[model samples]
Structures are given as C-alpha cells and as structure tokens.
Target chain A: MSSHADVERRLGELLRTHEEQVISRWTQSADAPRDELTELYRAILRAIEEGGRDLADLRGLLAELSRSRARAGYSPAETSKAVFGLKGALYEIVVAHADDEVLRGFIRFARLIDDLGLFTFEAYAEAREKIIMDQAEQLLELSTPVVKLWEGIVAVPLIGTLDSARTQVVMEKLLETLVETGAEHAVIDITGVPAVDTQVAQHLLKTVFAARLMGAECVISGIRPQIAHTIVTLGIEFGDIVTKSSLADALAHAFRRSGVQVSGGPATRVTVRAEQA
Target chain B: MERVPILKLGDLLIVSIQVDLDDQTVLALKEDLAEVVVARGARGVIIDISAVEIVDSFTGRMLATIAEMCRMLDAHAVVVGMRPAVAITLVELGLSLGGVRTALNLEKGVALLDHVRGAVP
Candidate 1:
C-alpha cells in the first residue's frame, strides 16, 4: 500500500515533467477538440498537485466537457473515449522511462482515468436525459393550446394521447381562458386525438364537469366513427355534456347557444367563386 | 365569528365571500343568506367566491346546501367568480357542485340569473 502511494506520487511528478508531450499525445488520441483537451489536462495537473486524492476539480472539468459534447450530439462512447485517451498517453511515458515504480504508478493512473471516463459517460447520459425532458415539456405546451373561436366561445383542439397530466393542463387553460374571455361556451375538439380509452374518457368527463362548474358550457367535437364506437363499447357516459361530430358543428352549437347568427351573403359567395377560379 | 355580507340587488341577492371560511362562518353565511332570500322574496341568488383561496369539503358542501335551500325557497342560486385553483381542488375532491349554476364573474352571474328568470317565466 505504501509502495502504491509512492508510485502514485512518482506518476504525478512524471506527468508534470513531461506535460507538453503527454498533452500533445493525449490530444492526438482524444476525440474531443484540441483547446478543451489542453484545458482538461491543466485541470488534471492542478488536481494532482492538490494531493491527487481529491479529483473534484478534474471531475468538474470532465463533466463540463462531456455535457457540451452531449449537447453537440457526440455519442457516449466518443465522450468516454476522450477521457480514456489520457491512459494511453501516460502509458507511453511509463514505457519510455522503463522504471518499475513508474509502471505501477501508470496502472494506478490508468484506474483513475477509467473512473473519469465512466463519470464522463454518466454526465453525457444526464445531459441527454435533460434534453429529452425539456422537449417533452415543450411538446405538452405545444399540443394543448386554447384559442378563442368567437366572442363568448373558446376552443381547445387536443392533438395527442389524453393522459391525466395533459388533461389537467387542458382543463385549467380552458377554464382560465373562459374567465378571461367571459366565454359562456367552450368547444373541446378531439379531431387530432388518435385514440380514446376509458381512462381518456374519464379525463374528458372531468374536464367537461370542471368547465360546467365554472359556469360555462362545454361542447366536445371531432368524434371520428371509430372513437364513437369505442366510447359506446367502453360504456363511458358523457352524461348530458354535448358531443358533436366535428369542430364546425361544435362551433355552430356554441354560436346558437350564445345567440350569434351566421349566414353567408352574396359578397362572400363572389369572393369564394373568384378564389375557386 | 366573521359574517359574510349579503347585498340585495332588486330581485337578486349577491353574497360575496371575502374571508377564509371556517365551519362557523360558512354556517352563519348560509343562515343569513336563507333569511335574506326569504325576506326579500328574491328571484335569484348569486354567491361570489372570487376572493376565496382555500376550501375544504365542509365549505364545498355548504355551497351546495345553500343553493339547495335557495331552490326550496323558490329562488335560483348561481355560484360565481370561483378561482381556477379552487375549482380544480373541488373537482379533485370529487365535489362537482352538480345542479348548482355557476358564472365566470358577478356581471355574468347577474346575466345568467336574468336569463334563467326570463326562461322560467
């Protein structure tokens, strides 16, 4: 154990003495950029000078490098390989010296490099997971959008799998928009929703009930034939809540309930004809 | 116990709950509202909870009870100005406040009352 410590100290000294050669060799073998490798090499030397036991500084530098590489679309193998490159560079120095003490130290140093390579792999994976989470949150925001279709009417066009969390968001957004716009009518269009199970049906029912409790009427529209059949088979009752076949039907229902009349005049017909031409 | 004030507007009674409702306060408001609704022979009752932040099951039940009592007295009850969080909490708590009318705000509540009265008579 004492000899192991001695070898570790000798490896640190060897690294300092042959700093330029080690860094150049390391840079050539590493997949990372030249500047980053130089910075990481310096950080490792600083950490070694501090007592070699605390590799926190070196780990921080490696973690930062791996994170950036992860964001830049580098693969996990490539990122960890960049850290492992240090072992090969140090092994060359040990062989040149041809000393048993330095060779033992090189083995210890190789283990340290292996630990760092694993750390880099973990950091890269974490960064990739964070990116996936952020995109998922953005997708949630993008998919559930509540827009005003008319005065006293708002529409929430749901376009994905209806889960509890998504439904909760949709319900809240729709209710808030209702209060803001003073809309007595709301249209929840499920045209973009691909499937509807019992759980999805329950979520829809809860949302409608919540809207109704807030003193607004909700009309669910865009029910495809398959979804309609599924709703019947699932034995899910919408229960007095109006369901329409399309968004247009829902909007027309909303307009009728809100006392709005829509009739196309001759001027509109002429424009339609011109557009067709 | 703090009392929630009830203001009468023509044939309608407006009760806006401005404080955190404990059991006693909710009960007192229910009694006071019942008395006012009867004395005024009010055609509609609007209970506004715009400022209410938190509600337990008891308070939720009281709202429904008051609405039911008003209905028994031959008056329409409309709950108004419920915040999004309160509404969500009530929904999560499984209290749909069914059979009780709701409105977005005081103005809408009044409009709804007028509409209901017009439809009935």
Candidate 2:
C-alpha cells in the first residue's frame, strides 16, 4: 500500500518529468521533427485513466507537465488553443463521472486549468490582466445567450458590466439570437450594472448600433442615478439608443413604437427628440 | 453624440439609460437625478434600458438599491428594456430587482408608472 505522502511525491515527480518532456519536445531541433509531443498528451491521459489515482499526485504531475509545455516555446495563440483542448478533455472526464466524489478532484482541476494555461503564457501581461479584470470577458463560463418571449414580446435583460470582450460576445450572440428568433424589438434592462467607465460605455453604444444594423430596435431600461450622472460628465451620447426606466416602461414604449395598444388602459406617450451630436 | 437626457412627464421622470450606464457620466447623473427627484417631489420614475448589453450583479444590486432610495424620496421606480439573454443570466445568478417596477420601453413604462402612481392613491 503506497502511503499518501509517497503518492504525492511520486505525482510531483511525474509532473516534473512531464514538464521536462514538454520543454524538450519544443526546444528540440526542428530538423528532427518530434511528433511525440502529441502522443505524450495521450499517454498522460491514459495514465490518469488506469487505476485508482490519487488526486494530489495527479495534480502535481500535471502541474509540472504544464510548466514544461510553457518552457518549450509555446506561443500565446497556441497556448489558448491548448487550453481549449485541455478543457474539452477535462469536461469529458468530469461529465463521465459526474456524481463520484473522487472525480470531484478532477472538477476542481478543470477550474484551475485556465489559470495554468492562460496566466502562464509569457505574453502580454497587460492583456492577460485586462481579460481577467471583468468576469464577463472570462470565456471559461459556459453560457449561450437565448431569447425568451413574454406576452408576445422579446426581452433581453443584461446582468453585467459591458467590457469590450463581453460586448463583442453579446453583440454576436444577440444578433444571432435576434435573427434566429425573428424578434422585432429587443428590451435590454440594465438596472444591475454598478459603474460605467468611458470604454465600457462606448462598448454599449457599439452594441446598440449593432442591434440597429440587424434591423431590430433596442430598448434600454434601468437607469440608476449614478449611471445617469456619469453619462452627463463623460459627455457620452446615446442619441440613437432608446432608453426607459423599467422593463414595463420599455414594453409600453415598444407597443407604441409598433402601434400596438393594450385595451382598457389610460394611453400615455412621450415624444423623444434626440439631441444632435 | 450628446448623452441621453432624463425626460420628465407629469410627476414621473423618464430616464433613457444607454448600455454604458457603468461609466463616469452615468455615475455623475445618479446623484443629480437623486437630488432632482427629492427636490422636485417626483412621484414616479421610469428608466429605459434598451441600449445595454451587460448588467452584472453588482450593477443589478445597485439598481435595486436605487429603487429603494427612490421610494424613500417619494418616487416609485420602474426598469424597462431588458434583453432576453441578460435576463436569463441575471436569473441564473439569482439576482432580484427588490420590487422595482419593470417595463419593455419608455412608452409602456411611462404608462405603467402613471398607472402605478394613480393606483397608489
């Protein structure tokens, strides 16, 4: 029976060896092509699959392997791809043994994988920090934006700050969803956002512009006072983006914009004249 | 482009919120709006949100807080123009508006705000 500490030591050694192999594979003369690097990844997975592996030991081994891979001239672009591939593999393993406690370790391992893969890349430190600064930009989360219908209208409730990266994701996803669902108007409620800097504000403007480009009207709701003040101070204009106080207000606005009216209610309308930029 | 202005209709103020409500301009407007509501004795408020793409929990909580503060100052708050995707995420993350009124656009929201105010009597 191998002691737990022994297993840990062995796992560390394995990781160190894996690291060395990765480094050596990359540093080796291209004149002598080494296709074995790919094979090594497979071998590592196979080793993990065979028998009751200790979590600590496996982590140790994998850590060293990742370090070696980084040491071996792994370019940043390649690093991102590798991270994705590793994530796929880890996802498979976690899904395969969903309820197993021992597999819990693998799930934890999966979460840490991004830290190892992305942060370790000896690339632009500023770019890395920027990507990690906002949770919206972290592509690690698995979420597909979808349109939901309520009372014959489409509503898209925004729940996070719009960073440039996330803005791109939202724009792409919203456009795709809008076209797919044939939503004529989109209501975007932003009562949840805390603060808006100039760049973040610009990113939202771009989204509104993108929505119009897709032949859909976008409505903005949830104007907290702090946000209102910032907009005035920064002099950022939202001439084209339609905004309201709440989702209900947006729906009413949409009804008026589409010329649809609910029966037996007091009709209220506000004429909005966009100030010239 | 000039920033979206706060449009007042009757006792309610219609604020069209852009996507970048987290920026400095919006931040400054918060205090200004709060003061205006308190001083003006506005009975209702409607904030339009058709332009936003993201609204994290921090911002979401702030809006809820704003609604609470508005009520204390004798104004009812309503949020509108929420995108479906963002709504899904906010729900998944377990965020609530804490009883703030919501609408789809400025027109319907204003109507509802008026209704809510009328009903309050």
Please report how far candidate 1 places residue A73 from its true position, in Å.
Answer: 4.8
Write down the lDDT of every candidate, Cα atoms only.
0.87, 0.61
TM-score of chain B of 2: 0.85
What DockQ do you compute for every candidate structure?
Answer: 0.78, 0.02
lDDT of 1 by residue, A1-277 (tens): 4565576677778998998898899888886678888888877776655657788778888889888887798898988988898988888888899777877777767777788899998888787788899998998899898998888899999997989889988988998898788888999999999999998988888888878888889999999999999999989888899999989889878888989887874245433345555
lDDT string for model 2 (A153-239, tens) is 577666766666566666667766765565657777777667778887766666665555334577888877888899889998888
Q: Is the docking of candidate 2 incorrect, acceptable, medium or high quality?
A: incorrect
- Candidate 1, which segments miss by more than 4 Å at Cα? A1-8, A71-73, A96-104, A264-277
- The residue pairs found clashing in candidate 1 are A215-B102
- lDDT for residue A101 in candidate 1, whole number 0-100: 84
CAPRI tier for the interface of model 1: medium
